[model samples]
Target: MRPDLRAHALHWHDKTRATQMEFGLWQVWEAGWVTAILRGASITILVGLVSMAAGLVIGIVCGLIKWARIFPLSLLVDAYTSLVRGVPELLIIYLLFFSSVEFVTKVVTAFGYAGVAESGYAFVIAVIAIGAISGAYSTEVVRGALGAIPNGHIEAARALGLSGGRIFRRIIAPQMLRIAVPGINNVWQTTIKDTALVSVVGLQELMRISFIGANSTRHPFIFYLIAAVVYLAITLVSQAGFDAIERLLRVRTRK
Candidate 1:
């Protein structure tokens, strides 16, 4: 077809689809379904943020151990990063669910309480599981960032009689962070997507809620499509924020 005719055909197709949606997409919004999905989305965001924060802490500690080549400790960090990175994230969640649940239950019982419900502890487990996976990747990112800093700079700082803490605080930390931001951002993106996996263990994050909505309403495509759009929105907004941070870092570096 000619260009204008093709455009007209495409527009007509979209209009038809919009008009003929069998269930009327508006129905999904009428009975608080949209509110439920949005609430689930908020949980998804919370899980992602908290998981990433925990991952950053774990990554920094493990990365530093490996970077400093801290003997057997570095070896242990290596094993941790390697194991977590190599495993499927869902398997990790399952492992934590089965393993930690009983142990935590027993502990709670010992403390003069009935065993806590699975749902009660699901969020904590999700955070730890997702954080560990993110941290595994983040360890490599941080280690590489630390490695990128020239040895000469550290030596020079030492030669200037700067204390170890001062050298790290003044020169090393900032540059390492700048170098690591892109890698960390990559991990952050992965972490958010991985939150979807936690749905298997029933954490009620966005994916699980979407699945529930889809099943309950018999509108799988609509709910899943909405989920995709929400995920994309989150990713785009996060990308923009990271981009701004990166540009700001570059400007400071130039100064």
Candidate 2:
């Protein structure tokens, strides 16, 4: 190689090394980046919790209707569960986000509701989309739980002249929930991971923030690693909660 070319090559190599090294240097002692990642993780947890709550309601309602074989509603419930389970979750999020905006805009304009801002539209869509998909799986869990309840217990409840609400709340809900714990735990874990997909729609969840950090610092490895560790920590904590609930319910059953 020519002398000038060799010197330029060496300089370029050293510059690249320095840039890579910056990741190590900053990550070791930088509190701000750590805080940013923590904040992002908080958003991820909030979204997961909200989505799970919505999903449980949807699942319970749909499961009950389908379990009873309610006429036309049963067919509609079947279609919803089939569609959500058949489609990719990311595609659902994208569809909801785009479609909901147009929908809300038209509804608001039609009703003469002024000042409809989209500041939180993405977050709303994320929760609803994730919930819709999670609910489809949860429907099976709830239905199976309901099926496992002996017909005799329901007959006894009916014989006792108990109202429908009392029978369900006192005799059915508890047993069904105990049976559904493991399934719901699986759903919660899946829903948590699914929040990462919402980052694609520009929500500032953990993955999106980590992606931004990676590009800004030219340190994809470190940022992605942090995000992974954060996600695992959240999962571990959530698992512990579910485990405790399962243990409590089991003890109650033994008693």
Which candidate should be chosen as best, given lDDT against the real structure? 1
Candidate models: Cα lDDT each? 0.91, 0.88
Q: Give me candidate 1's TM-score against the actual structure.
A: 0.88
Off by over 4 Å in 1: 1-24, 103-119
- lDDT per residue as tens, model 1, 1-255: 899999999999999887656554776777678888898899999999999999999999999999999999999999999899888999999999988787888887787775554435778889999999999999999999999999999999999999999999998999999999999999999999999999987788899989998888777888999999999999999999999999999999999
Candidate 2: deviation at residue 200, Å? 1.0
Runs with alpha carbons beyond 4 Å of true place in candidate 2 = 1-22, 25-31, 102-118
Query: Which residue pairs clash within candidate 1?
Result: none
Poorest lDDT segment (10 consecutive residues) of candidate 1: 112-121
lDDT of 2 by residue, 167-244 (tens): 999989999999999999999999999999999877888999899888877678888988999999999999999999
lDDT of 2: 0.88
Most accurate candidate by TM-score: 1
